[model samples]
Target: MKVIFIRHSEPDYSMLDKAQNPQAYVEFGRDLAPLTARGRLLAQEAAQNPLLDEAEVIISSSITRALETAFYMARHRAINLLVEPFFHEWRPDLDGLNYTEVELALAHQTYMVNDGNLPSDSPIRYETGAEVKARFLLALKKYCQYETVAVVTHGMLMRQFVPLDHIDYCQFVTCDIDL
Candidate 1:
């Protein structure tokens, strides 16, 4: 099986500043962030890339940005887009507490540095990197029957499964799997 993982396009963070509550902004932004104009163009360009020409199925995270990114390719290929919540980014704070970007960054860094063994005292309830990898692998197994598949997901989740220092918006990594 051939699986291509595409990260969501650039997000528009302008609305975040206008939010009255930073915590609410962070919570809402996770699912509400839309693509910037350039992001849309990038997605359009990605749709025409030869790499996706052979894709027989398109699956995307339930997040708005990912859905928007996948729309271009799905429409171009005339395939129905499948929405999967399992592909969504890891949520560190289930309590919906307001967390600054700096805090979030530090937490992510710690998570990576510790190999996903978060400190027991940590207040945030999040899936460890290893957990994300396990779930992603499971998702792949579920879709192994397809000859060619395109998955649109978050960069954080992708990093757990693919070796990469960074994943640019709309960028994709392809892997051939033996089912």
Candidate 2:
């Protein structure tokens, strides 16, 4: 199976500060955050890249950032777009009071570099690396029928399979697997 994993662009996280309930935003709003103006522009430009020319289908994370990026790419190509929860970002244990933003970033970095094992004292008991890889493979298998499946997802999630130290906004990498 061949998959083109694209990371979504910069999101406008400032919206959280303006939300009626800031605590609610802290708990669940990250997934709902949309892309910034520059992110939209980047997505539009990336949509025209030749890498996406042979894509038979576009699969995306249900999160708004990835979905909007997929929408930009799919609209011009007229390809079918499907949302797969398995493609969503690896989540942090968001017990609003237990973890600090800095700790969240550190934990994610630890997870990515250590292959998903957090320190014994880590506040975020995130999903294991094995779990992440399994779900990502499942999405690939499901879309293997298509000649090419373009996936719009998150950087932390793509790190599980993509061979790169840094995955930038609107960046994409290709991978192949035997079904």
Candidate 3:
């Protein structure tokens, strides 16, 4: 069985700068938005990948960006697209203080390096690494039964769910193991 984890393309965060108050920024982070123009183009390019074109089944996070990406691929290849909420982006709330670009970047680094775990001081609901890992591993097991499946999701979820044996972010990757 082969499962492909695809990160959603770029997101437009221009409005993030307008967040004059702390509450607004937190709300902005929580709000789900669609992809930018570049994101759509990137997704289109991703669909063109030979490996993706060969996928027998397509799955995606319920978020609009993932759904949009999945739809683009589904249009090219006749396949039913499945929506998996578990694959949604890891949305952790920041402290009431608005985020500095540096802080936001560091937060992403911590989540990736720490397996989606973050410090207690962080304002996020703070889902544990074990929780994210458990759900992701379970999703992988459930999805990998098929011979070939493509999963479109956010970068954080991709990092969590992608098998460690093969980690390549440059483009689509294939792995033989279920891990």
Cα RMSD (Å) per model? 2.2, 2.2, 4.4
Which 10 successive residues of model 2 have the least lDDT summed?
92-101
lDDT of 3 by residue, 115-149 (tens): 56766676444445566667766776776557888
Steric clash pairs (candidate 1): none
By summed lDDT, the worst window of 10 consecutive residues in model 3 runs over 161-170
Question: Which digits, one per residue and each the tens of the lDDT, describe model 2 over residues 120-179?
Answer: 876567777677788788776777678778999988778778667889899979987677
Q: Between which residue pairs do clashes occur in model 3?
A: 93-124
Return the TM-score for each candidate structure: 0.87, 0.88, 0.71
Clash counts for the predictions, in order: 0, 0, 1
Give candidate 2's error at residue 118 in angstroms: 3.1
lDDT of 1 by residue, 97-164 (tens): 65677767776777777766677887565668888877777777777668998999988888876789
| Highest TM-score scorer | 2
What is the TM-score (0 to 1) of candidate 2? 0.88
Those runs of model 2 whose alpha carbons end farther than 4 Å from true positions after fitting are 94-103, 120-123
C-alpha-based local distance difference test score of model 1? 0.81
Candidate 2, residue 55: lDDT = 78
